[model samples]
Target: TISYDCDTYGNPIEAYYAETFTPKVALYDGDTFIKYIDSNFVVWEDLRRIDYSYGLNLKTAGCNRKPDNNWDSLAKILNPLTYWTNVYSKDCYSGAYSLSSSESSLPFPIMNSSNVNGLSWRGSEDGHYFFTLLVIDPDFSYCTLKTQFSVSITGVPLLVSTQFLIVLSTTLAFILVLAATYFFHPSKRKIKPL
Candidate 1:
């Protein structure tokens, strides 16, 4: 979250306390701060490595691009904060995952948009994901963001191999051939099941 994105009174447009209590991501266009949220809630605070010391630095360069960094950094470079902004590549094996928040992460960002106009992933990752956001107060003084909040993001599925696809195709082809032979063959033979 940034200074310009907050409402005049200081609450984010995505801050919903009625009906159901939930914090949401805010989207900005030009000078207008609008409320935008979906099934998955991502809280992104850009520390931007400016305060890099031990493990509290937030970098924007991207994770998988660099091999020297740890898996946590590489896997979550564009996460939580920017993931809701756009659709991202779901490749997690090579650890080359990336996402874009400015664009739609889902196929049609505009189609699945909420009232504030943001993209929503209908379990695009296949797994259920809960995120945590670390918020720090302004004036560089005391803070209450030490606690992490859970989000509504979904997780992705595991990677499968081409061999599996080949096997499945072969099995389906054999079944189709057997049915074709039974129905179209001249003798119309019937074989009993074992």
Candidate 2:
């Protein structure tokens, strides 16, 4: 439904909606402008949100920290022109949700990344925006690999718990098997040859 294209600097270039032939959203990532997206696309626009929400309003402190203001001041406090740019420069993977080398899935090389360049709002109560970038190989089996970026409030580390679950389950199963083998022998007793 939604498709996206990003440059090496991590700025969104083109966004396409499924229903139409032309791209509904066009992002301009220049010094004069940071993020200019078209919200008219139907389905593709919806998919773009999956990544767009990240750059919407991620705030951090120190450099562009603004206190005594709400999210309304986000654009002023942070450079809306380079706001999304900051979100895509991180090297941490927080919300990739699924990153694998399988053909059925997108082949993303860069798992997750975060950026130190952030902005702050709400009296700096909320930190800057945290960004995660994913690099897909795009040659996987049944899936199309593509480059995508995710934006979130600064300091929100991407928690990966599924890998741990699988490891724990495997360990428990192995332990249980060992216990059963120790208590229940499969081999029958040999008869004495007179």
Candidate 3:
């Protein structure tokens, strides 16, 4: 590995070390849960430790589905992406519902801090999502490590879909019409005059 002492072009220097390093990356869930990561997938469970990420589904009980044609090839869907946030806090990751930016320069950064801050995931309401980590080289050049991961959440939706709303509205309207007709019918009127 080489280091530029003062600045990008300050003092060109080289150093050799006995330790060996392979280009690799790992996620830290603070031991509160387990995660699976590889060339094709990155999954974590029981990560409720990330408090704010509730709706995003870091640890869903039992939600799963097979990928469909709607999803592009895994390579295209997961690779070459980046995300960032200046408002990162303890539970912010779990609070995120979707990616806000599309630029590829802001990959998720792993820090020495207890929290691996600045990455957000799409909430489980939509199913599978694209996740990416930046593989930074000692020399500063980097590429994105990408994967497709799903969250299985047995939780129920806060609101039903549009189709459900439409059906329910129609049913209520029909019932209202029947009740109004029954009450207004001339044959059913009963009046007593003194």
Candidate 4:
């Protein structure tokens, strides 16, 4: 269990004791884990869209282990949480920009919700984008949790469309016919002494 002691009058005899809970946070893409290019980077193809989601892997431990049907109510009453997302063009933690002033322009709109499910985003330009998912315990801001990740949007070669493929196949067949006729003509092939 999580125990906290508070002394208001600088006297041990008047100390207050209480129990608290801590929440967990994890980033997800629908039901699957987010695909990462590396430990902290993700790759997004040009013109491709992706949906982001998250999960709270809160386990029963400490002061969180409450009786059935009471855990949710108690947690909500005790730990009113807040969730938000941030996007950045550069790494603020590495001093590329100040954390307070480094928020980048969002390419797509994000819903204001705790779950973040069905939040769709499409990468239109090729660049490096950083994202953060933050959860704050309103009662104790110091207990906030955050997950940071980066996405690198890269350009992909254009694919030949169906029309292009048909045209290419017709041209190749015509060339093959010309080559066969020139190579296998009776006049071009000399007859051996039969």
Using all chains and alpha carbons, the TM-scores for the candidates as numbered come to 0.26, 0.24, 0.26, 0.26
Instruction: Name the lDDT value of residue 178 in candidate 4.
Output: 99
In candidate 4 the C-alpha lDDT for residue 140 amounts to 25
Error of 3 at 50 (Å): 21
**Candidate 4, which ten residues in sequence have the lowest lDDT sum?**
13-22
lDDT against the true structure, each candidate: 0.34, 0.31, 0.31, 0.32
Residue lDDT tens for model 3, 103-162: 212222233123233223334332222223333222332333332222222232434676
lDDT of 2 by residue, 8-30 (tens): 22543222221111222234344
| Model 1 error, position 28 (Å) | 18
Give the alpha carbon lDDT tens digit for every residue of 145-192 in model 4.
444444433452234585598889999999999999988876855778
Over 1-194, each residue of candidate 1 has an lDDT whose tens digit, in order, gives 22332232243323111122234544445679765533322233243221111111112322233222232443356454333322332322256454335311222111112323322333323322223343322222233222233323323343466558888999999999999998888875688899
Top lDDT model: 1
lDDT of 4 at 36: 27
Model 4 misplaced regions, further than 4 Å: 1-121, 124-129, 136-141, 151-188, 191-194
Question: Each prediction's Cα RMSD?
Answer: 16.9, 18.9, 20.9, 21.9
